[model samples]
Target: MRFEKENWDVIIVGTGPAGACLAREISKQHKKVLLLEKGQADLSINIPRMLKNNEMMFIGNGKTLVRGIRSGGTSVLYYGTAYDPPEELFSKFGIDLASEVEELRRELPLAPLKDELIGPAAQKIRESAVSLGYAWEKLDKFIYQDMCTPGYFPFDAQWNATRYVNDAINSGAVLLTNSEVTKVIVNGKQAVGVEAIVQGERHKLFASQIVLSAGGLGTAQILQASKINKAGEGFFCDPITIVQGLAEGIEAGNEIPMAAGMMFKNEGFILTDLTLPKLVYQLFSFQALRPHRVWQHRRTIGIMVKVRDGIGGSIKRGKVHKVFSEADKLKMQQGESKAREILQHAGAKRLYSTVWTSAHPGGTARIGEVVDPNLKSEYDNLYVCDCSVIPTEWGLPPTLAVLALAKRLAKHLLLRSYHRR
Candidate 1:
């Protein structure tokens, strides 16, 4: 790979939540930062179209799961559920979310979906949760609420990672799109730079610090290319299954709030609405429909069961291999049972379960496994900042948590640079 003398203070590997947040923070200090994204910078608000083409959507591996690959990364396709991290996980990493909560709130505030915005199907799911004694709450979303109009549903509420990417760029960080990092360049135990292929041409970027936010699969691929075997071990995505139930009175094509409410179980599992794009809905309907009665159900409600599994998966060469233990399977079954109960309460006629996959994969390059307490890889100056750095299965949406961790990591790097100064 040819070298460029345009050195950067920090070179971020992915333009997802962590990278964008870190870039925004570092650029505030007027530091030279280079953010490399593997895909194009398209921020279209059309969820159905994006889902169809698998362009900006999280289409799991052709076999089982759906993962995102684009400039905004998975956030561009995920249900915009902004969640708080598990306090216990952060304490283990010496991260203080309280210190950053105020700032986080300012950036990403949680607002309940208005009743008019949530369709009858979603409301039914909520009602079911309440009936079962399971606590259900409206989810906090990171969205530009005004853009979301009634009847537009998920389109109105989803704030893709492009928002943060644009913020980083506007804050003066240089963003290089369609740049896929293939190798982490290490020199005698200290990380020096990365070699990436942009437009089929290889380019090497050197930086004082490197943050890997290339997502669970991408990060694992980079580590494998760099001979970092520990990166993909213990990877866990909130393995989710969508249960579809036929709802009466609701139109089949009616729009529902992408994710209006959540039911967090005491067993570390969460049952929430699976707000799907039209294509996903069609697929689920096709699968759930019986052999002779494909059109029997006019309305469908989806509930996602995110199980807390003791057995996690691993990402190897951009593929996820999940090992569901008996206990994990049992937990998933229990979650499904609860979800069915909710749907039944909600006046669902026929119930069915879709295949399980995960978009929130974490713990690949977990703390103490691939990185240390400070998120530093074995090679100095190399850091993994995305969900891959999560030491345990967080059992929740990890975008907010990843951003907070990135902020702390950036602060740590800044302090280290200050001491060197």
Candidate 2:
């Protein structure tokens, strides 16, 4: 059978934040770039109906998580909470994030949710944190204020990757959806192209530079399939546990935002609010069918904690092997106790824990371990720009860090092109 061969100046896999950002930067310089995704492109997937119906389950490494698999990737399912990358953490990895911060401020909306928008449950939590004299603050999220209504929640304010992907496309970058890259074609330890499955047929795409933004798991899978197993070593995720609280005089509704405030305790753990769909409450709340008097007290809040994980994990064949160390477990327990304390102060009547919940999973391809400081893999012309490249367990979410790295890598790639000329 005959196959078609296409050449591009650059080919990026995954249309998430990193890929979309890189594509946008490169395309502005007039580079012929192709962005490939394993899912379909749809912005409206953020709508409640779409998200609930097409939720994909990812289970491995002793945890089960759900996320959207469409064109915008997991952004469609993300709670849209935008957190600033811890500057000190990136500096340790030899990354300068100052300029990235400036760019982010210019491009994205970052502010605390207004008082009117904060639900009664969240306000009580905040008040408790203040009373405890803990260092806490409202979290800024990427959201469109205009779209928010009294009873309607706008989950898209967080900088969804779809916007960046669309910007890249508008800037002249070609996008290929429903294309799964199966292998990286290498010659003499240098990657020159990729082999992908599109419409049940095999096709090849060549590029001068290849960037893997295929996310933590997808990046590891692609690297492993290409006989590059070291990329899967040292994988780390901020193993999180959600503690839910039942409050009095509160109803089970979607008015509450996903993330509102955060408390960073001295015990090296962080606690924040957690919101879920109404269906989630119906399934988890023990008193779901109580009378209006009892149901009025069905307020639920979430506390997410990040443990100090000394033992790094691994990902093999789409399986995540995360065995918590003694220290990690201890940290989680400590965080849980603190969360209970906060709930008690906030007048929580009952508390329950979720089965499995964690948003950020990073370090699958750590810097200086799997990929070099420049994010280039041991294989030539192959690079990674995603949360997978984080070197250690960041106590906070990693979207901002991933974007900073992508911006820096784009500059590096551009300089290389100039030098070659």
- CA lDDT scores, all candidates in order: 0.74, 0.72
Q: Model 2: what TM-score?
A: 0.89
lDDT of 1 by residue, 1-421 (tens): 3335788889998988888888888888888889988877766545455556444333334324455667777787677777777787778767677766557777774566766666666777877787777668777777666665656644545676777778888888888887889999999999999999977888888999898998877887898889888777766767778777778787644544445555454666787876566556666556555443344434667788887655365666655577666776777898898888888888887688876666666788888788888889888999988888888766687888888888888889888878878
Clashes of each: 7, 4
Model 2 worst lDDT window (10 residues):
288-297
| TM-score of model 1 vs. true structure | 0.90
Where in model 2 is the C-alpha error above 4 Å? 1-4, 42-62, 256-259, 263-266, 283-298, 306-311
Question: Whole-model lDDT, candidate 2?
Answer: 0.72
Clashing pairs in 2: 61-320, 142-157, 142-158, 143-157
